[model samples]
Target: MRTRLFALAAVAATALSGMSACTDSDDGDGGAASGGGTRAGAGAGKVGVILPDTTTSQRWGTDDPKLLQAAFDAADVPVDIQNAQGDKAQFQRIADSMIAGGVKVLMIVNLDSATGKVVLDKAKAEGVRTIDYDRLTLNGGADYYVSFDNEQVGVLQGQGLVRCMGGGATAGAEPPMIADLNGSPTDNNASQFKEGYDSVLQPRYDSGEYLKGPDQSVEDWDNKEAGVVFREMWEQTNKNIDGVLAANDGLGNAAISILKKDGMNGKIPVTGQDATVQGLQNILAGDQCMTVYKPIKKEADAAADLAIRLYRGERPTTGDRVKDPESGAYVPAVLLDPLPIAKKDINLVIKDGFVEKKAVCAGRFAPLCRDAGIK
Candidate 1:
């Protein structure tokens, strides 16, 4: 399969005579960076990467930054990658330091729209080109935006939930009462995800094929809070809530934990995204229905490519742009397709290097993995 990050290969600038690719093979010319932007090299400017809290997903801290750093390592450019840890104030402080340290490019997965605007504005005033990574900054504006086709992510999640609920057009059947534990209200991707799933669910709801239950966005994709909130919603309705429309793997796991307590794990349909280790394990063990897999390597690579171009004083080009709802600006974007992973589709991620065969097939999961033809 063609790597999704290869979409902008042609637009990769060839001006770096001293650059190197991340791999020795034909992985394309846009891979290398210096030991540090401070090191004596041809591309001497650092790129700033500010990821939102690690509580929401492990990828932001453990996986994504490493991928981006590897690509930067190949390009001989330096990067300052840091995590905001869900604190808006910390996010601003980190951005301020990056800008003051003379980073040429700034990429962020914002904690919320309010503080994001402040950081992005500061970066712009300092002549730092900004790229909205994973989450858009709304009206804050940026040089580019890169992420998965989040709406499609919701479509997959919604469809998965419906299937798990035994959805059909049979007349007079009452649809399941589903709880929507969406992501943080501060993030734009959360809203886009809702838009995607709502496209599928609202129609079903309108036709009386699905019943809307308690629907609320988590404050910061807080799993602990998700558990508390969902439990209250479900218990308040006398445990009549039939299933869940969880926004991501974290929330799904949160709800699954609650379901396990009530002996409802895998008994009712639940949907998720991000395909985290916990989410996949839940799927293999028959505790969760599915999780959408958005390859972090592809996303980080694309963001790194854009950042490299910006740091090199090259005008990066992208034909596709995502509309900023608040500003009405069509910010250039490279939105990749997300894969829906069920019990059957586990091998695709393993084969594509998105997950470890060892991680998926270890110990208790061995039999389940073998049963799924993972071996």
Candidate 2:
């Protein structure tokens, strides 16, 4: 592995000599997180990263890039990172550009498995070591994977919703009507989340303890589209939804928006993930039931350590292996645990620096933050 990495780097360095380096100013560039321009001959041997988009979750645009960049910088590694901004064609273009520019290591948070397979396959063909940052590429076959235990994230979501709905196996005269607004159907993490949550919720549905209501997936985890889909669900059920199992904070907030229109925000318990600022505030406001917080800094540091070692032609080892359902292959993985955050746990997110106190405590959330014992 070490010998092949150096050979690939030598070839890339030779190839990059003739190419004009490009900067973050280039079209479709989310801009470099560590340094400007992939064209820098000095950085041609550096690791390259491609983020999915700035939309679906705030972490993609703001949190992950910042944290990942800091990790690489602290290790004194020259890295170039950019976001695809949700365009498949653009994602390919960026990957091709990075490969041609001579990056020995390539990392990505895939837009989807199909597109991700293409990128990972190309990188592997060029002998460039590949790492799946967060979302796994079904059969893409990257060299390594680093992320939180996603199914556990879903388990927390399901468990949190049950707790918010007043807990216990026994239902009242009428079982609460439950609905689920899942994430993008293309994202494997979404499937894993559904798998975990279903594991917990299915039993309740079978025993007549909870009524399964409208369940649908947002195409791209689009927030506006999420609101539209949820509104139809609300109408289809005649506004009888007693709880919402939203896959993430964005979708959870969308459900809350529709619920607010009907003056039912706090009346219906809703579940979320990502521990986003909006989701945390919603919990404080009594609009959302709970959120799952996967510390992205820890994930980024783990990934960075792997990438740095690979960039230096060192093969790193991981104790965990995740099986790819499609390809039947096991991937070396570094999986982190996730925390469930209710109203009382909101301060934990703040204290951990996952989110800033000013951001969550701003405006109308000030009093709520203080009441929650947030210092």
Candidate 3:
């Protein structure tokens, strides 16, 4: 497993280096140059990207890197991308290496928020600008944070589950029982998602319109752990679970798998985030209810642009300010909105080219794909 992971990293590094060298002659601003005008910041310093993990979702391997690389290439900035594969020690080592290699800007999707805070502190001390990508690194001094409106993401999850419970007006009488499986405890986004979801669900729960079972926070957002946790919840609840509020697609899928084993497939509604291929398939298959669609291209582009601006000693524009939990300092942040996707809007995700139809429709899902008009 270690060898395969390292090999994948090597391939990614080589690919990035090749692309960087090819685009080195252009200016780093990502703007087209006039006929005889010199490119802006031509041969600018390197930009290092430290991604969290690939095991959790397919987006890390496909959408994230592709979009980020395109944005960086257009900006003409060289990039060095690495995946930590959910290893905190490996994440630290990767950050250290990037800093030592004289990277001017560093972007990271931290696997562990506490450890990430330490890494960000080191980057700040070394004068390297840091952009917290997707997941915020709490208590860490981050120059900029780029992500979706996380609270809204949770609200969507809550609302979707409520909808899945059937008529909102009669939800009180039915009072579907649900299990809440949140993401990694260390990630600040997890809390933000919980806030949004709870804000919606708590009202229903308090009004006796819905019954919530055991709510568990999965460590590292591990699907296997989520499966085990959910299985235990199933047994504890005597298999009376009617709905599930899973933090993301990976965990939702894990929960769904366990539900299927218990012969509860398509009977309960499950919520998810990050409109991953599997999540979308599950939606079409009637196993999962909905997923929050956060366009990776928009996010990756924004982060790259902000990182470049910071590298040039410019403050990027951001609409929101988030206080650092540890430092008590407010930082500029760009918070985008999230879209909830169901089987009906699967075409929208496809129209946006977030996922290829073939990728989602392959294997057993092919027939379902055609039925859903995925072509």
How much lDDT does each candidate structure score? Answer: 0.79, 0.83, 0.78
> Candidate 1 on 257-283: residue-level lDDT in tens?
888898988897788888887788889
- Clash list (residue pairs), candidate 2: 21-39
Q: Could you tell me every candidate's TM-score relative to the true structure? A: 0.88, 0.88, 0.86
| Alpha carbon lDDT at 77, candidate 2 | 96
RMSD of each: 6.5, 9.6, 9.7
List of clashing residue pairs for candidate 3: 28-75, 30-74, 30-75
Q: What TM-score would candidate 1 get against the native?
A: 0.88
Candidate 3's C-alpha runs over 4 A off are: 1-44, 168-174
Full-model lDDT, candidate 1: 0.79
lDDT of 2 by residue, 1-375 (tens): 001112111121232222222332344211122222332223348799999999889999999899889989998998999999999999999999998888878999999999999998887777677899988899888878777778888889999999899953353567788999999999999999999899999999998889899999999899999999999999999999999999999999999999999999999999999999999999999999999999787788778877776676455555566888889877776677788999988888888898999999999999999998999
Backbone clash count for every predicted candidate, in the order shown: 12, 1, 3
